[model samples]
Target: MLCALIGSACAGARDEGGTDEADGQGDEFGGSQECEPDPRGTEPEVALPSPHEQLYELELDTWGISNAGGDPVETRTRMNEALAWALDNGFEGVRIPAGTYRVGEKTSDIYTAGIELPGSMDLILDPGATLEMAPNDTWNYCVVAVRGLEDVRIAGGRIVGDRDEHSYGGADDEGHGVCVEGASKRVLIEDIELTKLTGDGVLIVGQSEAGSCEDITIRNSELHENRRQGVSIVGGIRVLIEGNEIHHIHGTAPQFGVDIESLSFTSKDIMIRDNSFHDNQAGDFVNTDGTNVWFQGNTLDQGDVTDQVDGPIVFWKRTDQTIRDNVVIMHSPTVNGLWGVIGYTNDDEPRANPVPNYIEDNVFEGGGIHLARNHGNAVIRANQIDGWMILGSRLSCLRLSDNAVNKAEGESYKFREVQGVASGNLLNGAPVALPMSDDAPFTNSPPHLW
Candidate 1:
């Protein structure tokens, strides 16, 4: 079996000699089972394996760190000391073997972090390696903190937070599982499970005035049952968040799966794709307030529960944004208010127009798209919506086309004082007329389909 797997992997590699044949075995009938050759007369480019894929055989026990599951004092002390020593000794990576390592104590201050990673290091955790945080009341710390670093990778472990023991007082009493701050760059956080945290599972922010967190990627992680967001990006550039499962986030006002917002700075070039967000209580499942953002191929669902979610995707004063090819399934019949797949502008803030945005080719199972306030040069096309497509007052230069809405309540297309062209749309199996200019007050109604 091992040989067959290796052979299969090697067969996928491109032939350097420009051969048009696959290097694989035969079928049960002794027929060729190789893949078809690429007809494009060009050698396929081979991707280099990631450095984090290298196995670390050295164990934490070698550095006098005990994994004895109780009283994390000694283990935490040794782990911190070992990290310092590894950085000073020029070690490329440190391995935490498969065991539960208790990190912080219940009585410790909220500002205490379990491990602080140095620059240019890989902290590899084995499959069963767990960092269990001691139950505490404070909310000002994190299990792992990476700051002012470059080329840092934290992969393959479980971070258990003390949510059951922690109490939420206010914004001051918030903790996190992992916090990446300062001028960190080229960071990769992958294949980790973060559960039951008092705050966000991962918080990536930029604190320095001269620099921003750059080129950060978080993928293939599971963040669930957290009190706050699954991942919160305060300020970062060129961030890619893909293939994560974030769910059941509650106990806060904005318990989003991913929250990308600007704090004292602006973030750019953010892409969130192929992630799963379900049962989060936030107004927006994946909220954004940044520039050049792309959210594609994600599944946002509100499970059959009593929680009220404002929307699946919310944008606030964003530019050059594209939300395409996403599926949003809303099953919460008792939700307070029904929201569309995409919501624009915030209630309290002054209405700012988002320009050059595209909402295309998305499937809204029980919702539609809401463009609130003024919007400019935006295109909403080819979407399958099961609810209302609402356009607020003063929207200009908008193009709505080829959208299909089924079982829509009230008006299939609700336009209030907007100048837009809506054409080629089918509503309740009939060609929709141009949206009527309604003077009804703007209100997010419940799903009438249910």
Candidate 2:
């Protein structure tokens, strides 16, 4: 009867209630009735892992390098030789002990780099180790230069540039602290202190025709008081810059903390997050013109100091970009004729068409956000602005929603021939009702009156 009901033949006889008599005896219809113990009743023993790579110490004193600072010409020569030896002998890591090392001119006409890190090397510096640069006019100036390398890691050091010692002769003659350029890949630079450079603190450039240097990471670093940008990326891909402190950058015209652009190609897939930017000389704390870039959780403050910064962020011809969860306080009196918390513009023809830009959940104080002649689809939502907001003359398809704008001196929202929707926004604690309709407007004409 049980086999007929279950549509299968039973291995043993069934009881009166249609239960298998051999149910607990490894029968086909049943299993053993005994309970099993849990395997995770006790914690498993674990072992401490070994270091990822072997460490090789380079004794500067053994190479006739002194801790007492002097002319670094000889030291630079020995340092490069040691680096070559390490690379040739297949060393994975090298450590420089704590000391002050001065680097100056290597030859009469050429200034040598303090250290040049090659491919597949981990260079570690002791906590008190310092590399000080002396003044020179050479264009090949850098404290650490990594060129045409792959899989390099530079961690824990102090690089002080010769800003006081060197004279700047335009942009070409300036020196950088750390430069990674020319076909470099998988470089990790972290936990370094860079200050008082004649040019920029760090520069990642791609000048090669083969391809732009890819997969670079810069984190937990401090760059301050540099002549130009704190960190400048000319051309690179998949770069991650996070948890950095950059400030007091005042040398060139656009003295930005991070400047991302390209001279030959397009820079893409870059992420800048959780950085602290304050007291920078220019208003554009972060200036980017790259595609698919993300800037989040960054804090930009122009302290009570007058004429410190002009704006928090500026983007040009960027696409698929996002700026969210950032607190930007632009309280300084406008300097260098630039003022705004956020600035967007597109002037280059064959323009990439800065579209689909999302600026949300950001807090802006003192100054407002501005859009200048942009012809893309943008969404400005859920922002708390303590100043005025301006839309340029040629903007199209903009959606502004749920934003609170406290009027500062002038108008709360200024529209200059913009075509967009203003819905659920608050201007001085009242709902804003602009004359927006479901109709396509003509070119160079106002969407509706404010």
Candidate 3:
């Protein structure tokens, strides 16, 4: 029980935060017994003693090595210094005792991290403590910046920014609560509240120097009231973004409650689930580039509007993905785009073709246009679609069959006499005549079925 050992010993700092590494036991994702070499043979050397073991050694040395007893604010400085000392002296685990710690210069009165932990370390924040950032220092934002490190975790605590200086990255300023560099991996950011970052809130960004960011998880958190996106995921592999409430993240820089975009390289195996996204203006809840992703069991609600953003979930240049069991509610397209899941071939030659994507068991209701425009091929089935049919008569060229189309707001079309079924549908206008309906499969008629 390495985590238990660290947890029990660091219990004294009820206010300050401490990192708990569960004793060499494996977690749901991967445990100690599952540690394996990279299939590519380029595995980064796995450190011995596990990070938890190293943390235990550091906690013992810190018992009376230093103290931040003068002012509660000094706790932040002490925490950073303690870890700095530990790292300098070859100690590994750094603990942060809790309490309200003020950041920035007292004369300036700007909120900031009382203690700053430099890049590269295993640091923990106690549940009761708070990390407040400076208001006037938008140029100097972000309470914690993890730059070029491996095996990092910031769990359980609150990181707040001054609402008055809410304009940190007002228009083009680049500020954040916590910005992780690309060279970092095995990162876990859990159970935290990040509020009012002028730029992007809790950004997991990749730098040019580092090829890509990988193996990240952001779970059980609340990201709200930021000038920009609540959470932005870029340039990563095997990313799990789940169980988060992202809302009221409005800003001038094309904001999205939760945006999954690619700046340079593509991200793979992205699983976004069990989350709630609502009230975002600039764009729909989820946006992304071509990648193997799974969007499941989530709720997306767009309030009253003329053009209620774009698609609740938009996929471009994507392939082999599954968009299932999602509840999309509001005033726009449940799905919009050539391919609900598009295939993109970048570069003149085009690398990967978009094909084999699944859009099933989704519910689209009220003022939403459910259409799939382009892509290689897609499967749209078992979806409860109701509202404006914005696409021209011809929505998709690849495939369409066994769908319950009812009370469509606009026109509908069939494959260019190419032969796809349109039988089991409740068409408000019966759609433009198709070349053939017998070639494809059609079942229960609209009113009777859906």
Candidate 4:
């Protein structure tokens, strides 16, 4: 169940769960690495242990926390004591049983396993429990973090933000729900609910280096009404984001519902499927930077969008991405901005490629599709676009074939069922890019959008 509103956006929002651009020291060798070596190839695989070994067997109550002995009151003492004890012991995880535990401030780095290196840890939540963090009047931070940790798994339960009177009501910004940073590989976050955050819902964002956030799996969770990006990721490789319910994405800042950027970050090999995105007022439900991504088997419903941000799903320049096998329904009534899939990219080659993208096997109930950028390929084929609208240039160079447009509002839909329009779109908008077309095609489509 959702908790009280705490306060509105005015309350100081929670901080970013992931680390900022420059927060940790250059090195933290003060701590030794404790995790075992991963055998699933050095490429960082997000693999969970066997069910029996997965259990940490360490309860928050057993740490001599304030409320651990009984149905004790929520306090800072319990949180500190519990977390400290977990760190001191050899336990790799700290479980929160069914209860409403509250902490007044930010604790030390408990999520990550290695400070300078990368390792994994687990934090499991019992059903129907809440972990509330007292709203900070100062800087915003995350309820929990997996920063600099590899093979990290945070699953189950609900993470709540307590922003009653002390909560800043929209005054504070940069707060986030949960953040998984760059260089953190094989991270899995599933079966949880994150609400009432003043910032983005969950951010698997990138940093300065070209490292990747690979093998990430987020399923069966709900993210609502975040102040910033709902699920923001940058500079990732081989990521899987599926089976989550994301809605009501309104914020005081100019926030996108979800964004995947690869600007000087090199975000690549992402699969986003089997999710439900609805009632968002900002930009697209899914947006990508200049990288390679695949968006399939999802449902998008536009509800109460009162802003000027573009797209139910928008991709920036030079991004070799795919949009297929999904259902997108919009009810904007009047033509608000350039309604539909829009692309925008100029300049060719070297740093940026203006190639067309490959689009196929999708069902567009309403709205339209636009090649927002001038570069890259737009391969629209074998799709069912009913009541579709187009908002881009002529596709004389595009590979348009084998598509079905029910009521095309513009001429771009003229090649739904045709061939050779655009296929294998790539970054820098190159015509022959083929960025996200993995060597081995995915055998199974992702689960449906929540």
- Residue-pair clashes per prediction, in order, are 1, 2, 27, 66
**Lowest-scoring 10 consecutive residues by lDDT in candidate 2?**
1-10
lDDT of 1: 0.65
lDDT of the candidates, in the order given? 0.65, 0.65, 0.51, 0.52
Among these predicted structures, which one has the highest TM-score?
Answer: 2
- Per-candidate TM-scores read 0.80, 0.81, 0.68, 0.70
**Model 1 regions more than 4 Å off:** 1-61, 105-110, 167-173, 283-288, 318-320, 333-336, 342-354, 435-450
True lDDT of residue 3, candidate 4: 11
Residue-level lDDT of model 2, residues 1-450, one tens digit each, is 101211111121111122212222211211112212111111111111122286579877677776666668877777777877877887787888888888766454545467777557887888888888866766547898888877788889898888877754545334788888886888888899989887788888886575677778888999999877788777877788889999888866457788776657557778888999887876434444567677888998876547653456766545456787888887654532223444444232322343456778888887667654454456778988876553433344566789888874655665543456668888878897765422342223223331
Q: lDDT, candidate 1, residue 79?
A: 82
lDDT of 3 by residue, 121-178 (tens): 6666677756666555434456677777777777667777665544433243345777
What are the per-residue Cα lDDT tens digits for candidate 4 across 82-140?
Answer: 54555456556656677665554443322211111123556777876665555555335
Q: Considering only N, C-alpha and C atoms within 3 Å, which residue pairs clash in candidate 1? A: 139-174
lDDT of 1 by residue, 1-450 (tens): 111211122222111122211111111111112212111111111111136433344455476776767567677777877777776776777888888887874445546557777657888888989988776557577788898877888889899887887655555325788888986888888899998888889988888565678888888999998877788877888888889998888875467788776566667778888998888875334444566678889998887445554456766544457788989887653232455444444322323333456788998886667664433346788988886444443344456789888873665665533444668888877897775222212222222211
